[model samples]
Target: MRGLLFSSSKASSPSNSSTQSPARTPVSTPHHRTFSASIQEEDLLYAEQVIRRWDLDSPFYTKLDSLFTGDRREARQFVKSVKNLQSAMHFFVSESASSEKLIHAQKLMQVAIKRLEKEFYQILSANRDVLDSESVSNRSSRARSSVSNSDSDEDDRISTWGTSVSDGERATVSEMVMADLKSIADCMISSGYGKECARVYKILRKSIVDETIYNLGVKKYSLNQINKMDWETIEPKIKTWLHAEKIAVKSLFSGERILCDYVFSSSEKIRESCFSEICKERAVTLFEFPELVAKSKKSMERMFRSLDMYTAILEHWPEIEMIFSFKSTTAVCKQAVASYVKLGDAVRAMLTGFESTMQKETLKTPVHGGGIHPLTRYVMNYLVFLSGYSEAVSDILADGPLQVHSPLPESYFSSMTSDDSSSISGRFAWLVLVLLCKIDAGAELYKDVAQSHLFLVNNLNYVVSKVRNSKLRLLIGEDWVAKHEQKVKQYCWGKLSFKFNEAYRKHSTWIISDRKLRDEIKISLSRKISPAYRTLYERYRGYFQGVDSVVRYAPDDLGNYLSDLFHDAGASGSTHSSSSSRYLSRGR
Candidate 1:
C-alpha cells in the first residue's frame, strides 16, 4: 500500500520536474525523494497560506497595473503598491515560517515582480505609437495654425505656443512617458533592480530626443521651401516667418545649444534665397544696360541704383557667413566680382559707342576757330566725371582678396603702381586709357596734318584742364596731366614747323612785275597762311630769329600780315589789300 501511494505521488508530480523545482536546483538531480520527505505538512500549509494571501492581493496588483499603464494618470498608485509588495514579502520572510515555506514565498514574489517588469516594458513599447501620433498631430496642428494666420495673429499664436511650452501648460507624450518611467524606475530602484530601470529610462530618453530632432527637421524643411520661392513676392513673408520661428525656438528652448544650430541653419537658407535673387537680377540688369542706357539719363541712373542694390545685398554675405559658420566666403565674393565686371563691361561698351559717334563728328568738323568739336567736349567731360567716381566704383567692385599681380610695363603709365590688374581701379585705368587712345586715333582722320595736330592739342588740353579741376586729378595724378600737356606742346610745335614754315617756304618768292597784281597775290597768300605763321613767330620769337632772316617776311611786319588771316575769301579785292597795308604799318 505504501509503494502504491508513493508511485501515485510521483505520477501526480509535473513531467518537467526541473521547471517545478527551486531555481537553485539542477534538473538531473536524484534528491527529489529526500526533498519531499523533508517538507512537513505544517510547512506545506504555511506555504499554501502565503500563496493564498498573494492570490487575494492579485486584484489590487492588476488594478494598479492597469492604472499605471493608462494614459493621462499619475503613477503614484503603482509606486505605492510596489513598495507595499516589497514590504509585505520582507515581513512574510521575517515571520515564524519554516525554511521551505519562506523560500517558496520568496520565489513567488520574485516571479510576480519579474512579470510586472515585463508588463511595464511591454506597456512602454505599446505606448510608443500613441506618443508618436500625439507628436505628429501636435506638429501638424501648429503648422496648420501658422499657415492660416495673418502676421499679427501668427505672432500672437507663436508667442502663445512658446509660452505654453515654456510654462509646461501643454504636456508632450514624451513628458508623460518620462513621468511614468521615473515612478517605475524609483520603485525598481527601491527593489534593487537599478540596472533594469536604467536600461528602460535610457531607451525612452533616446526615443524622445530622436523624435524631437525629427520634428525640428521637418519644420526646417518647410521653412526652406518657403524661402526658395519668389523673393520679390514672398521675401517679407519669409522674413516674418523666420523671425517667428526664431522667437518660438528661443522661447521653447532658451538655454539649449541645439536651438542655435537650428536658427543658424534656417537663416542660412534665407540668406541663400536672397543672394540667389540678387544675383539673378544683377545679371539681367547688367546685360540690359546697353538698351536701358540708351533710353534716357534716368534709365542709366536706374541701372546704377540696381547695381547699388546688388552690392548692398552682397554686403550682407559676410554677416550671414559668420552667423552660419559657412565656408563659402570666396564663392560669395566671386559673385560680387562678377557683377562688378559686368558693370565694367557695360561702361566699356557705352564708351566705345560714344567714341564711334564722336569720331564721325570730328572728321567732319574743321579745326580753325575752336579746333575741338562739341562731341569731343562732351566725351572729355563724361570721362572726367567717370574718373571722379573711380574710387567709389572700385570699392563696390573689390570685395575679395587680390588674385592677379602681373607687373604693368613702364610705358603704360609709371605713376600707376598697383599691379593687381583684376582690381576695379586697374580696370578703370584701362578704360581711361582706351578712351584716350580712341581720341588719339580720331585725330589721325583729319585731311590736313596741321588740323590733325590742332585737334590733338585742343582735346589733350581739355582733358588735362578738366582732370586738374576735378577729383580725377587724384586718380590719374599730376604726372599724367603733365605728360599729356607735354604731348599738346609737341603737337603745337609740329603744326608750326610743318604747316606754317612749309607754306612760307612755298610762297616766299612770289613777286609780280605789276605792282597791283603783286600786292593782290601777297594779300591772298597772307589770308591763307598768316595765322599759323604769326602763332609760330609768337611761340619761337627770340629762338628762331636767325632762321627767320631767311624768310621773305620781316619780323617787324609779321603781326600786320597775321591780322588779316581769317578775312573772307570773297571779300572785295581792294578791301583785302587795304586791310593788309593798314596791319603792316601798325606792325612797323
Candidate 2:
C-alpha cells in the first residue's frame, strides 16, 4: 500500500531503527553514488506520502489534527517518514546536491522538524502531572539502575514497559511522553534542528524551575533589599529558603537533570547543554539567598539561623555538585559554596561579637543576697543554647580558634591549653571562665567578704547547672562541673555561720513573714552547711564561758533563724526576748 522505504535489494528496513527507542532519529548512510542515483525514487516516493499531510495542495494537508498527536500509532510513522526523507537527502548529498528530489526532501525535513517542535512543546506542557519532579526523578533513578545492570537492550526493554496509564500495549502514556520527547529531540538534532529544540526546552523548563523555586519561597533579593529588612521580616524568609533548598537540590534540580538527561540521552552535548541551561540561573539564585541573609545585620540571635542555612547547604553540597556536574551549570555549585562560606563568616562574626561583648562587661552592681546575677543568667543561657549546635559550632570555631586575651589566671589557661584550647570544650570552657571572672568581680560589690563568696557560689552553681543539664555538659566535661561544684561547697562554709548570727541580730525583733521562703532557705542551708557547722560547733562548745549552759542558739537552731530573717514581720525586741527565754528553758 505504501512505497517501500528502500529497495529490497540494497537498503535495510527503516523499522529496524524503530525498535531502538522513540528517541532515535532517522540516520543516513554513505552508499555508492550509483545506488542512491538509482534508488532515490523509492526514497522520495515513500517520503512524499508523509509530506502530503503538510503539503498545501495535497488532499492529506487538511488533516487538522497534528500528524504526531492525532493517532498514537502515527508517532512512529512520523519518525519513519523523517528517516525515509533523510535517505533521499543523502542521495542528493552523496550523488547529486542539485538533484530536484533533494529540494523537496529538504522542505519535507523542515515540515517534520516544525511538526516535532510543536509536539515536543505540547507533550512537555500537557504532561506536567505525569512528569512532575518526584515522579520523573523516580523514573530516572530506576532507568539509570536498569541501564547500569543490563545491556544496551535495557532502553528497549524499559520503553516497552512504558509509562503509559492504560493496560496492555497502552502503558506508553507516562513513559511514552518522555520517549515522545526524546524522539522529537533526536529527530530535530539529527536534522540540524538542535537549536530550535533546545531553545524551546530551555525556555519552558527554565520557567518551571524558576516557578518551583519561587513557590518554595526563594527569591533574588538585592543586598539593599535584605539589608534594609529587619530580623522579623527576614527570619521567616530564611526558614522558607532553608526548607526550599532541600527540595531544590534533592528533587527539583535533581529531577530536572534526570528529565533532561532522559529526553536528550541520545546526544551528550545537546543534553548537557539543555540541562545546564534549565537549572543554572534559578538554582544559583536559589542557593544565593542564604548568602544574602548572612550579609544582613549580624547579631547573636540571627547567627543560628544563618548557620542553619549554612549547614543545610554544607550537608547537601554533594548532591548539588552531582546534579549540576555539567560545565555550564558549575555556577550553581559555586554559588552554594559561596553561601556556605559567607554564612559561616557571618556566624563566626556574631559569636566573636558575643564574646567581645561579654569581655567588655564590667560587673559594677551586685545582686542582693548573692543570688543569681543577670549577667550570669544571660551569658550562661546563651552559651547553653550555643552548645546545642556542637557539631556546627565546632566546625565553625575550628576555622577561627578561641583567642584568649583576657586577664585569666595563667594556671587555668595552662590547664586548657594542655588539653586543647582550640577544641570546642576549651572554647566553651573559656567562655565559662570569663563568666565566672565577671561574677567574681560582681562579688566585690558585697560589703561582707562572706556575701561576696556566696555571690560567686550562687552564680557559678547556676552556670554549672546549665552545663550539666544541656549538651554543654558533654562539650565542657564532668571535670569542669566537679571542680566548680567543689568551689560551691567551699563558699557554703565561708562565714556562712556569720550570716546565721547576723540574721538573728539584724531582725531579732521581727517575726517571720513568709513561712514558705523560710522552710526553703532552711532546707538549702541544712543540706549544704549543717554537717560541717555541727562538727565545728561540737568541737568548740567548751570555748564559750559561763553562758555555755545558757547558749540558747544551737547549730541546729541557726537554720531556722537564718531562714526566717529574710522573710520577717517587724516585731519588737520583746518578741525575740521571749523566744530566747523559751530557747534557754528548752535547752535546760
Candidate 3:
C-alpha cells in the first residue's frame, strides 16, 4: 500500500521527480527545467510563507545574507526565489507525502540551489565588467575635463567629474559589486561546492578590499578633506584614513597606495598655498617697511619681527617634504630666497632714506663735542648688529645650509672686492659702501673746509674703531678698518696742508713785524683762522715743514706767538711777556 501511494505521488509531481533524478548529473539538461516547473504555484506560495517564518526564527541568516548581498537589486530577488523553492519542497513533502517523495523533493531543491548559485556567479561576473568599464570611463572623463580647464584652475578641478554617476554613485556601484560577489561565494560554500567556493571567495575578498579603498579611502575621504589642508593640519586626517581600523583589517596595501596619492596631490596644493601666502606677506611688508623704519625704534623692531615670522615658515619645509615626499627641495628653498630678496630690498631702501635724512641734518648744524653725530652712530650700530648675525641671515636667505665666508681680504672701501655676489653678505657689503659714500658726501656740508675735514676724520675714526672692536670687523674685514683709518689721517693732513700751513705762511712775517702792528694782525688771525692754524702747527708743523710748506716762522718766535694767539687779557697791539706762554718756555 505505501509503495502504491509513493508511485502515485511521483506521477502527480512529474516535474519534481524528474528534476530530482538529474541532481547527480554533471551538466544541466531538459530535466532541470522540468524540476523548476514541478513545484505547484500553491505549494510555492506556502513555501514563501514558511521561508518568511524561517527568516523570523533565524534572523542571523537573513541579516548575514542581506549584509553580503544588499548592494545588488537582483540579488534579493534571487535569494527570495531560492528560499521560496526550498520552502515549497519542504512544505509539499511534509504534507502526508511518502519518505521517497520527500527525498526526491529535497534533491530537486538542492539542484535548484546549485543552479541559482551558478546564476549568481554569472551576475557577479557581469557586474565586475560593468564596474570596470564604468571606472575606466570615469577616469577618462575626469582627465578630459581637467585638460579642458586652464592650468591655474586644473588643480582645483582635478577630481571633478562630468558624469551623471557621481563619486557617491560610483561608491554605490562598487559596494554592489562587492556584496554580490560575497553573496555568491557564501552560497557556494554552504552548498558544499568547496573548490568553486574557494575561487569565488578569493575574488570576493579582493573585490571588497579594492572597493573599500576606491570608495571609502580614496574617493570619499580625500575629496572632502584635500582642499582644506595646510602645513599644520593635513597629516592627521591622512594618518587616520591610512591606518583606519576597518581599512587596515581589509586592505592595508590599498590604504597605503591611497595615502601616497592623497598626500602627494594634497601637498602640491599646500605648497602652492604656502608660496602664495609667503609672497603676499613679502609684498605687503616691503611696501610698508620704509615708513616703519622711519617711524621709531618700535617700528624697526616690528619690521624685524615681521621678517622673523615670515622666515620661520621655511623651517617647516623638511616636515612638509617628509610628509608629502616632495620631489624637489629646491622648490621650497626658492620661496625662502624670494622672501629674503624682498626683505633685503626693504632694508636697502630704509637705509637709503636714513642716509638722505642724515645728510640734510648734517648740513643744518655741525656735530660737536668730539663725538660722532647721532644719526651716524645709530646707522653704524644697527649695521654692526646686522653683520654680526650674518650666518643666521644667510640661512634665512638661502633656505638651506649656507657657509658665511669671512669678510673679503681686500678693503671694504675698494672699488673691486671679491664677494660671493649671489650671497646676502655681498648685498650687505654693497649697502654699507653706499652708506659710507653718503657719509663722505655729507662731510662737505660743513662751513669750514678744515672743520669739514675734521668732521670726516672724527666720524671715520669712530667707524673704524667701532668696526675693529666688534663682530662687524669679521664682515668689514681688518683691511676695511685700516683703510678708513688711513682716510682719517689723510683728511687730517689736508686740514693742516691746505688750511693751516697756508694761513701760517701768510701771517708769519706779520707775527715778527713791529710789535704793535704784529699784535693787531695776530689778534685778527686768532679769531678767524689762528685756532685751526695753531692746532695744525703745534701738532703737525715738523712733519709738514719741507713737504707741505716752507718753514714760515722761526722756531722760537713762532712758538712764542702761538702761545699768545688765543690770549684775551692783552690789548690787540700789546706785547705779552713770553715767559707766561707754555709753548715758548719749551722752544728748541
RMSD (Cα, Å) for all candidates, in order, is 20.3, 10.9, 21.3
TM-score of each: 0.34, 0.72, 0.34
The 0-to-1 C-alpha lDDT of every candidate, in the order given, reads 0.45, 0.70, 0.45
Write one digit per residue (lDDT tens) for candidate 2, span 118-154.
7677777766767767777766756454323322232
> For all candidates, what are the clash counts?
0, 6, 0
Residue pairs clashing in model 3 are none
lDDT of 2 at 449: 78
Alpha-carbon runs more than 4 Å astray in model 2:
1-40, 50-73, 145-174, 406-419, 448-454, 489-588
Which sections of candidate 1 miss by over 4 Å?
A: 1-375, 400-409, 418-425, 521-557, 560-588
Model 3 misplaced stretches (Cα beyond 4 Å): 1-301, 307-371, 395-422, 511-588
Number of the top lDDT candidate: 2
Per-residue lDDT value at 433 in model 1: 60
Residue lDDT tens for model 3, 11-54: 55868666665667457467764564466455555444433432
What tens-digit string does per-residue lDDT give for candidate 1 at 511-584?
34455665676677666666656665576444333433333344445544443333344444335446555533
Best by TM-score: 2
On TM-score, the stronger of 2 and 3 is 2
